[model samples]
Target: MGRQLATALLRASSLEPRHINISTRRPETLGGLFLDQRWVSAVLYSLLNMCTAQKLGAGKTLRLLNGLFETNTFTYHSLVNSPSASDLNSPDDLFPWMSLVDAQTKDTPLTDLVLRDKGLRDCFSVMYYNVFSNLAEG
Candidate 1:
């Protein structure tokens, strides 16, 4: 499932597999797991950036995210079905359809949206920080 999501994101974005630092695991490494959070963060960031770069509408963005989630074995619900919220107070509250609709309706660029929306700015900041920190640790 992870591989599928990664592949799809890579195909959609300008990122290359080497950018994620993916490598073959050896038998000796089997006992220990190396779940690189940086890889996940990087892929997600790239995916979001691609969406913004393409100026995808809310419907298309939602579908892309839903498709990625559905790649896993678990039953995934559509993001559109999630209850709407007036404000996004935190990262957990991010992705309310209202925000996407606003962005789409206004045709706002990602940089402008990030600057104008505190919740979105904070979310991106957190993800960027995590990616850099994980890279340093790794």
Candidate 2:
């Protein structure tokens, strides 16, 4: 059930395997998808960034799952847009984010990260970045 969902999401996002992050509380349950353990930390950071970028409202959450229970990808974003409040008040929360691609790490080769990693490379075609507009009613 998990693998099937992950595969479906990979196809949908067109992220290519390298850009996806598969993680779980139980690594054994994820099976072979795990690449570097440090990826989990990266994922958390990405999620936190996205969440902090947007304006808080109903909030938005997206999840990408795969078949064979091999990979599981998740993302979420939430923010508060208020001119009266300063950006300093924003709360940074990542919960446990992970990504198929670690764009920030300098040492790791992207090709190796993509071609070598099983689930991360084989999942999607491209990674997406979302932008939010911060505008106050005139």
What are the runs in model 1 whose C-alpha is more than 4 Å off? 1-29, 36-39, 71-138
Error of 2 at 114 (Å): 21
Kindly list the per-residue Cα lDDT of model 1 for residues 39-128, writing each as its tens digit.
433344455556556666444655665465443211112122223322323333334322433433443333343344454334434444
The candidate that wins on lDDT is 1
Clashes by residue pair, model 1: none
What is candidate 2's lDDT per residue for 44-91, written digit by digit as tens?
334334443443222222231122223443222211123322433322
The alpha-carbon deviation from the true structure for residue 98 of candidate 2, after best TM-score superposition, in angstroms, is 13
Report the number of the highest-TM-score candidate.
1
Clash count, one per candidate: 0, 36
Worst 10 residues of 2 by lDDT: 129-138
Q: Can you give the lDDT of residue 10 in candidate 2?
A: 45
Model 1 score (lDDT):
0.42
Q: What would the TM-scores of all predictions be? A: 0.34, 0.25
